[model samples]
Target chain A: MTLNRRAFIGTGAAMAAALAAPAVRASNHGKPRVIVIGGGAGGATAARYIAKDSKGEIDVTLIEPTRMYYTCFFSNLYIGGFRDLSSIGHSYGTLAQSGVNVAHDWATGVDREARTVTLAGGAVLPYDRLILSPGIDFVEDSVSGWDVSAQNKMPHAYKAGSQSELLKAQVEAMPEGGRFAMVAPPNPYRCPPGPYERISMVAHLLKEKNPTAKILLVDPKEKFSKQALFEEGWNRHYAGMIERIGPDFGGDNVSVNPDEMTVDIDGVVEKVDVCNVIPAQKAGRICEMAGITEGNWAPVIPHTMQSRVDENIHVLGDASNQGDMPKSGFSANSQAKVAAMAVRGALLGSNVFPAKFSNTCWSLIEENDGVKVGASYEATDEKIVSVSSFISQTGEDADLRKQTYEESIGWYSGIVSDMFG
Target chain B: MNWKHDRFWGVLATVAGVGLATPVVAEQQDARIGDAEAGKEVYDLCVGCHEVGPDAGNGIGPHLNGIFGRRAGSVEGFRYSKGLSREGRLGMDWTLETLDAYLENPKALVSDTRMSFDGLEDKADRDNVLAYLRQFSDSPQNIPESAPTGRAREVGLSQETLAIAGDPEFGEYLSNECTTCHRIDGTYDGIPGIVGWPEEDFVIAMHAYKRKIRPHPVMQMMAGRLSDEEIAALAAYFGDLE
Candidate 1:
């Protein structure tokens, strides 16, 4: 069987690799093309790795709607006045300069049969491999009487950028001694410690600007990540400033009225000055458009992050249902490297090592008080399983806490560079 | 390194201290001498600057928690005088003998110590104060039956592992886990730089963390799972970064 360029495009990669000569790519079939959608932690890292490691052997194109990406990891610090908004925002200029063809447009549709993606700008991109790391989107009507349109009245600063700025402005402009309410999301959300961290930042802000201002946290889960650490910090730093209602207190049965600026928790409606309603989450709409999601997320093989339904596409970050690892920027960045390696090995026959995964989350409770939780993981046939883990002890010295906070600053710089460059 | 010699001295001091106590010697052979109850009264004089306890924080002087087994003038966030900093640089650790000597004559030990205290003329007073200070420090020699502190290197490397030839290409791939917090550019922004380190030093440091010798919890957890070959690979990769 003669392996021509036309036949190479039609056949599966595995079959062609076994039959065709290695020089076939250089002689006739041009570089294997990879189209990575969503230029955030997962997509950016994957695209950059494939482009850089392949050494011009593979054509990589990154499709993302936002040119300046605002990282959600440090947006809470901005809310607490520890960082400037500009510091957390990054541009894709560096990535574009380094081999990757940056496409500033939204992905509208995916045709798995034709192996092509349609953009909102009416451009169709064909690829031998596709990576979808679209992060997360709020589930439609996940919270009663709330939708994306109501975001202006009740900001869900989960995605960062302008929403974060607006939320900060709203919090700052609240009436003296006003009430701030947060409707937290359920289990299996992006950044397991995010909502609690945001609360800490809000409490930090209130302590400075309005000491009498109170925070009401309504959470659906019975317990949360780093609950003991957060509780201890809250007691020490922001005593009487914050109150949390867990599942036992009808927190799961929550509804909000953005127009009325009120929240209904178990038939008790409370007026609030600013409401942060973080609704339940699902994989980005692009994953659903590609018809790869199961239930609310795209399930992928832990080893390669390849979609269970389609071998041509790999899902990453918050969109991927890779077991054990949380939905975080750090987790996404880690998974992206593994996926990038697998993609290169599949497309260009590069060395693919056994997949190793790890993640750590640091949350600031006050000025110099920080806590963290982390775990190292390895891929088994069943799932990515945690083998070793650690978390900050409740009563640590101020020096260690301050060191942790500084380390987080360094991590912010390190990760943004890792993702963008 | 005189680590073994230092341990012997620590054990000897503990034994000598045990001879002075009657009932306390039954609980631990390394128990310090002097009345801790009476030393509480002696601590009143040092309370103007020094602090000790759960919520103890740095005042004019550094907080005294975990002072045992710690190097002199090495507390974070405190600006040590030139004399104490030099003593710490010269490897002056605060053990039973060192602390007692410093307490006996601050000026004689560290010529330019910022501490403005006269020498304790009474031997009994110095003994009591040293015992009271020892209560705040957790010496591994004093508490051998307690859970092994994460600061001890419990695991040792096999000669075979120490001799493994690392693959640099594999090292680059494995380094992704480290570059999350450590800058590949070698910038030390709160986190220490790892790029361009000597391979041997890198391997030794990682193994120390792997063995739970390092104090950082995150580093311990990260290094705990890495195989010997993986550590060697990372060392090789980071060594060649420059």
Candidate 2:
């Protein structure tokens, strides 16, 4: 069928109002509670969108154990000492201003049948719809001898708060000519190109401080996200400072000893002054309890972001299975919009418009040079498929790189405004 | 008198049933060619190449007037590659059904056409464009003022000399091989440099094909075959020169 432009716009507006009216009526009926778990990019955006779109109709109870969220997007800059932690770490005061009830409590369990959330404090909050965006829980067993305590010596820095700070501290304190090892995760992980980007940023930092210092990357996959661009950037900017270990070069297997800050590889134990191990991940605990997560991640219908297991609950961001879309801040934000639109359709008895999602990930290769890859996606029955994709080609014009770097910052601001403002 | 009254009552009931069904039947028959007027606006992007008029020069594309019945790559003063002429022999035509399938997904229909436009995603737009094209030249009486020479003679080459590697009988065999990725009709994308391409250019391109130069992997493989003489004969056969 053809979608008439006028009809689409009218339906969108009507759906918005339809979503708003119930929450409005419910507010007068003493507020339909909305308890959002996690305060990362996905959870925060979902909470903000629900609060704003519902027009104060929703009493949004955001349950995040952390007082502030430090974005993983810009954590590389913090690691490089280009920016401070305060810059990336954001508070919920802005959410609070939008009439969200921010609670510093972890969600212990979800009573999905009763539609109530059991917080750590023994207080039960009832919700008309529970949005679970609790980000990811790293698989500790993937790497031998790696556990919570082991992270004290060798930080994962996968989540961008204390781990990030500790990783940065270790990098700063490393002696000259020391070795820094970063273990890369396999495919279908959050920020597919993030580990490589992190390596680039760290190499950039290490070049001036300790010229002899080396950054060794061990990866299971032969090819990585944006392989051409990353190799070109590494060769041009940080020549000889970076060594990549692909599966072809016997880099597939990884065994780490977190306490020793060493990784054993193919009968050789390489001790490093600093180590960053990004473990395998799965959907958060809430999704497991809600029965939405199949094994590790939630299976969602691409068109609606509705859970395949339960239609009443919709999953968004990193939790939902959006094929070919890396778990990233930009992707999470895009998924949130789709989820918001679907939520409006479910509540208003209106048709959900077929959505088109697009995302771009920018990696800083040096202080000035950056690489980007992006794609537009459409939903099918099974998964979200790429309609059009583009990458900043190797040896791109200097002006284009500068323009893209600026575009990345602008996109970041625009997306943040669209979500929280 | 009672029997006559019963007959009259039965006749009235039959008429009433027919009357009730009349609008529904008519509605089914008169289905709106689904908003062709809306489709006209969407057709703006397509008019650049497919326009029909006396002033329209066969640019990189053929004049699309009376395209439905026309033999593939038969346009005069325009050159077609071997892929198109081969396809024409396979009884391919620009039928409405074929056009609909082509417009929805071009590459899926013809893997090696060069038209860069992605398929129109909206189904209604496809229907509208199809109707619009039908309105232009469905009848031979409305055909544009263009005469068709024999398909072989149009490209300025004779078929006998061109049939060096494969016979004219083998043209069907070669054509079968071509239709795997090429379209006889002009509706396919990526296969564009197919119809109306220069004969000499085709021969040179095939013989000179190299890895990574042709952009598509299959073309590179196909081009790797055939001696230079065979390439010329195939080019001549496709140029429809006889």
- Among the numbered candidates, top lDDT falls to 1
**Candidate 1 global CA lDDT score:** 0.79
DockQ: which candidate is best?
A: 1
Tens digits of per-residue lDDT for model 2, A113-167: 7777898899987776677787887765876667767787888898898999998
lDDT of 1 by residue, A1-421 (tens): 0112332122223222322222333233478888999999999999999998889898999999998999999999999999999999888999987799999999999999888999999998888889999999999888898999999999999999999999999999999999999999986789988999999999999999999999999988876777788999999999999999988999999999999999999999999999999999999999999999999999987767888888789999999887667889998999999899877776766555556777888889899898787766655333454545567888999999999999898888888878877
lDDT measured at residue B177 in model 1 versus the true structure, 0 to 100? 85
Docking class of 1: incorrect
